[model samples]
Target: MMVSRRETLRLAALGTAAILASHPVAASAASKVRIGVLRFGTVSWELDTLKEHKFDATNGIDLEVVYFAGEDATNVAILAGAIDMIVTDWLWVSRQRSDGGDLTLAPYSTAVGAIMVKEASLIRTIADLKGKKIGVAGGALDKSWLLIQALARRDHGLDLPATSDVVFAAPPLISEKAIQGELDAVLNFWHFCARLEANGFRRLIGAEDAEKALGASGPVSALGYVFHDKWANENPDAVRGFLKASAQAKDLLARSDEEWLRLAPIVRAEGKELAKLRDRYREGIPRRPVAEEAADAGRLYRVLAVIGGEKLVGSTPEMAPGTFWQEPPK
Candidate 1:
């Protein structure tokens, strides 16, 4: 039981080295999957995030996350190698695909995007959208498909009218713009959308309409896991794992508001009203996956071709196969 001083020093150094090795910050080298996700809420979700970093705690993803403010910025970050994958709206993915960007929908996420109109407005139906300016939080094509889908359901000729116009605005402000009478309608995801309803706006269209209207013959854009094809092909396992975990996270997020509430501080630290937003994204909205709707993916894409307004990624024709990542295992 007599340890020499030199031996103790040697053991001490080894212990220090071991401690350094286990440090989470250093252990998570940035070289891991740098998923560039959108920080949709004002609060930042991931900050130079690492894999398996417990957002849901259970079934967490093992990757790094770089939060981007919007789709355009997120795509730019992807090109710049700031991160590897993106989980954003499918419409953004469609725009990226049409623009010839190297991104693909390797997995399914959600399909809850919709269009809203003021209940009191004369634009009582999809056909009424003509000649009116619509504000879309995502973009024009999003509104076009929304109107197209809505029209297809109510009347066959009810596709996007050329006479209509679209204005780009933040998702949080879509309803506000409509209430102010500045926008005839709004197309957006659900977080603030429920608020619109509470404030008197009604749902003009939903994703189900996209499928019914297009009759499965066209491409429709919505939401999914968008990542660079080059990276996806090279790292299929990670892609699958990420998707699997995301799917699990989707379930977890649906079952409880605990995770969003726990992560609220990460958002509130930014001085943004994140708790309310978290409640908005969690309690007030629906969370579900769209893996079964591969057919709709193409339909959403075709709808984008009609808008032709945002060439975020590349030309329409270039938005072909080989760009879409294989559907993540269910």
Candidate 2:
């Protein structure tokens, strides 16, 4: 269930107050980092692993997790100086920097959405989508939808939004409509797409494939850990430790089936659904060098700017410099 915007703000305020009260020395403590996370986000899996194995302590930092009801709430928390970091996309970080904010991104996940249809559906190609009733999860400017549009235009010269009837709604609503047969297809978030796959849906095209078709060198992380530049500079060791701990957690989850089994209750999956979720999560772990990832992101950003226009990329003709954070030399 989703909370109202006002309620979410209230929760963020309370969460922030509690964090400050509990950590009176937070400002001076070089070994502490507070991260604002969505209550049900996949990030919890990594954080859970980090805590379960005491990875934070091993890396010499005190990790704090504050829950937010909505993405906007997390943004609000970070902007108001209530938290040190949050998970978000590079585009948003770029927009902030363009507007003179100092936010930067560290790669989090490369998993992207897919266009899904019922297993028996006849929509086997982009051309087949013409005249179909399509459900889009994140509205017109969604990165996945924009990428699909770019793919359609580049490969088949089809204008997806103009050719198909599109219904824009929340991810959950889009999933429900797709399951009910009201939509011929859906472009939804990765996790929802995974669930649909477990229940018999087929992927017609994945966003990562679309990216490759359009010009990305490889899979690019669409989301990442975002933090202020000044804060990171002030606590370099803490930031590096947190990132190290995050990588360790991902390595553990990638190699250990036993860990996933223990996380089953938290992920709320079983059998095929559990397997699908695990595999998808592992596929998203970032492995490319930071420079390579940044270059790919810059190319994709230009494509998005061209296709999505001012609405998606704002007034920035290119991604802002330092949008992807690079660790200082050891």
Candidate 3:
């Protein structure tokens, strides 16, 4: 369910106090603060921690969570003044900033997402892709696929076409179509990758390749928390307390698997697919941000521009100033 703006602030303030009582290390707060959160695979950890009482009942701001199909959808919530903050990809956030949205980037979340394919398929490498139909997500599949191809062309010496035999579908259907063999392969983020693996599919390549050894950021790992800059500036104390409690949550997730498992249902939604999504995230997409990743934000913006230009028409994605919030201090 979507959280209204008033309720978001109220709950955030309550959650902040709750976190303080438990940790006692967070910044002091005078009143409650609220945050509206988007629902997506990348920010799933923040959602989990928030839902798990990790942010409630203490010295932290209370977080009210809302699920969205994608960052763009969450952008709607932000525009409505319904959400105070968001955790999403830098690409969409940049676009929002360009749109004159008053949002600020606070911290990096996950990095590049990944691409997956079945082992039984003939698609073996980037060069092997040509006529195969690929399933993609949320109307951005073609753009994402083109982004992958751009990297292959720029760094790996591969030739790609202006278009492909890719199939566009929503998140839930893409995996199912790929599994049913209706599509050659589905390019997706990690949750689907893990689910496919559990169901016997082989990974093609993923954003995890960004481990400093792959000559690339690998698979796009940075996801960051976003919020209204105007609101955040007025609530610096709220921001500090929220991040403080979130830091604890990050540490907790890093050190405990049982805790993650317990919150899986709330985060991913219980079922076979949800189980696979939970496991997929566990294998990759760490709960903490890669602090140094702040440098790569510009590169991500440019890459997105190029792919969106050729693959999308009508308008170009915008890059916003102060779109990414500066990395928090260690």
Best by lDDT: 2
Of 1 and 2, which scores higher on TM-score? 2
> Residue-wise lDDT of candidate 1 within 254-279, one digit each (tens)?
55555556665554422234443444
Candidate 1 residue-wise lDDT at 252: 54
Give the TM-score (vs. native) of candidate 2: 0.93
Worst 10 residues of 1 by lDDT: 42-51
lDDT by residue (1-330, candidate 3, tens digit) is 223334544554544453335334223232345444445454666556755765644545665555555544455555555556666555555554554556667664453445667777778876666666777774552434556767667665765443457666776799888788887777765566666777768777654442232233433444567777776666676777777677667666665666667876656545565566555554444433443454455555465566666233214444456766653454
Q: What local distance difference test score does each model get?
A: 0.53, 0.88, 0.57
What's model 1's lDDT at 9?
Answer: 40
Off by over 4 Å in 3: 1-31, 38-45, 66-73, 140-143, 155-163, 208-222, 267-291, 310-319, 327-330
C-alpha lDDT of residue 46 in model 3: 52
Order the candidates by lDDT, highest first.
Answer: 2, 3, 1
At residue 240, give the lDDT of candidate 3. 71
Q: What TM-score fits each model?
A: 0.64, 0.93, 0.73
Q: Assess candidate 1 and give its TM-score to the true structure.
A: 0.64
Cα lDDT of model 2 overall?
0.88
